[model samples]
Target: MPAGTGGSENYTVGQVRELNRQGVPAQVVTVGLDADDGRSEFNDIPFRSLATLSEVGGLDGTIVFVNEPHTVPTKQLSYLILHNPPPIRDEQKAFAVRGTRNRALIVTSRYAAALWARYLDVDVSTINVVYPFAEPCFAEQPRPDTSAGTTRVLFAGRLSPEKGVYTLLETLHIDIIEQDVALTFTATTAGADKPQGKIIERLLGAHPGISVVTSRKTPATMAALMADHDVVVMPSNSQYWHETFGIVSVEAQHSGCRVIASDDGGLPETDCGGVVLVEPDNAEALAWGIRAAVASGPLSRAARQDAAARFTVKQSVNALLNVFAQPAPIPPATIIRQLEEQVLAPSAKVATTSRPDNVLIETAV
Candidate 1:
């Protein structure tokens, strides 16, 4: 709930709020997350920490686990929001696949559904895709005037190698880019406490064009920050990490910032107009993309309106509620296995209506 938090976790905070606002009562049930901790907005959202995750087995309700898979079995039907890509290690992958058992899996994008279907050997349709929506602030904030001489560029992702922060460093060091006085660079201190983050921040903060600022604490502030910049860069490293869906890409686009992102994973599925995709992990191509964005100039009013309509919280929340109203679409093989083991309930359902009761969201890291 604070700056530098992972996308999935940040997603949890917003989703729960929207769920509650829609009359679908939801509360965060945490495991070892201290509500008193000022490091995050845990105190802001409605959450209660259990002594252990095993306690989740004793609770009654439709359990909706976020990001990570739940470790314990539950009495009521549970749903898992499979946020990250499958683990690379065979053992980890096997464990993750096992965690999906007896749980309806909901991923964020079509690309994620395909990736997980291949990993789990299930039909892609069985894994639902409730595409993430940009917060209202991103779409509502008026785009800043770029008439100011410098073209502002921002790196909004976490300051880690996987996010291509180091690659961005390489791009900035290029002779042509380094000397281009028209371009001004900025980076958020997302993950600045990590070893790699500290190293990157030090290197970037020392640069003549870059300024490393603390990441915003809220979506409104983040939208304001993005609005000030003419371009947003997301060079996600495709070497191992495959982004299921690039929320930052959508947020930036909604904020009317021309995005220069790597064309990998679900980034292409971001679907918002006005993005300039480049080769993943290539500094030269990213630099070229920045130049391309600068050449294109600011987005028109019509383009901003289209982006605002394309990805809204209302659509996402409606889709999510629809998923809740229906039964979990378990594959035939999984259903057979569960039936044989007497684990499949005869009338298994995620929830009863658009606004279900007893919703508990697990914010497991």
Candidate 2:
């Protein structure tokens, strides 16, 4: 279900659309607020929403695929697709157990699958790695700007603490700006409903070279935005909430922009022909890397074409279909035992706090 507009939501929607295109019966079931107003963006695929899994029928022998870990009663044929393994908590452990007991578990990256499997101490065979597709944003006309002037760098994501917004700003303050590079920070502030947003806003307010742009731009517009930039920097912290596959990095490569992403999580997996990798949360390293990327010549035409070929929607669908075709099953006793353990274990409490710095900023250039 598309609960919000993030990597998982985008990946889910894209996979569903591709599957439907391949003549597979797939439907999107959404939970939480409808980010797209319940619009069927996919041409032929159908979508529905329900508060709980019990509301739906014919779950028996049906491969119930879930993006996140949650309790969903299903028949023998079911699978769990995890974009990221939940943090260390009793609920997360229970979710792992449920995932291991399913017919198969699909993960976006090997790193994520390994994390889940290690946490649960289960066989890694149960997990299948299926990288998400990068939405193509090829510029209609190449905007080659090799003037040896201030390099323009773009970063797109939520301005959350886990996302390393503060780290990115700090890197600019210590590195990019110091090197006379222009920084463009674009994000969907809706997800940054935390104190971290205030920190990012303050950083933006103080930095003249840094512009925070926010809006749900269409694919074409996004491609134009990427084409205008020389490089894309993804300086994310290696927290539980880090990038899984980093669709933006692939998109940047597709847009003919050099990508400098953190080595943490799945950033290294988006190897767009030796994509630059920097350490997480290290402003100095990020700064040095940004300077090098800015100084380097524009991405070769071959790199962009290769990225487009590697991360197409059709490839993503085929990878998922291969996972679905696998004949993996977990015994029922293990599921019941895990459920019993969950009931016996103390409930893990999680506290969420919201902050007012979540407002979207529209930069007037």
**Number of the top lDDT candidate:** 1
Q: lDDT of each model, Cα atoms only? A: 0.82, 0.67
Write the residue-wise lDDT of candidate 1 on 157-259 in tens digits. 9888888887898899877688899899999988887898888888888887789888887788899999999899999999999889989989988898899
Top-TM-score structure, candidate number: 1
Model 1 spans > 4 angstroms off: 1-4, 37-44, 331-333, 336-365
Local error of candidate 1 at 300, Å? 1.2
Q: Model 2 scores what on Cα lDDT? A: 0.67
**lDDT of candidate 2 at residue 208, scale 0 to 100:** 67
lDDT of 2 by residue, 1-365 (tens): 22334677677777777777788878776654444534544444577666555654344334556565455566555677777645668876775566455446677887877776677666676668888776654534467565555467777665666666667777766744555634444444424345766666666656665776653434555677778778888888875566777877877788888888889888899877737898888878888877788677678777667777877778888987776676656644466688899888876555444447765544422
Superposition TM-score, candidate 1 onto the true structure: 0.88
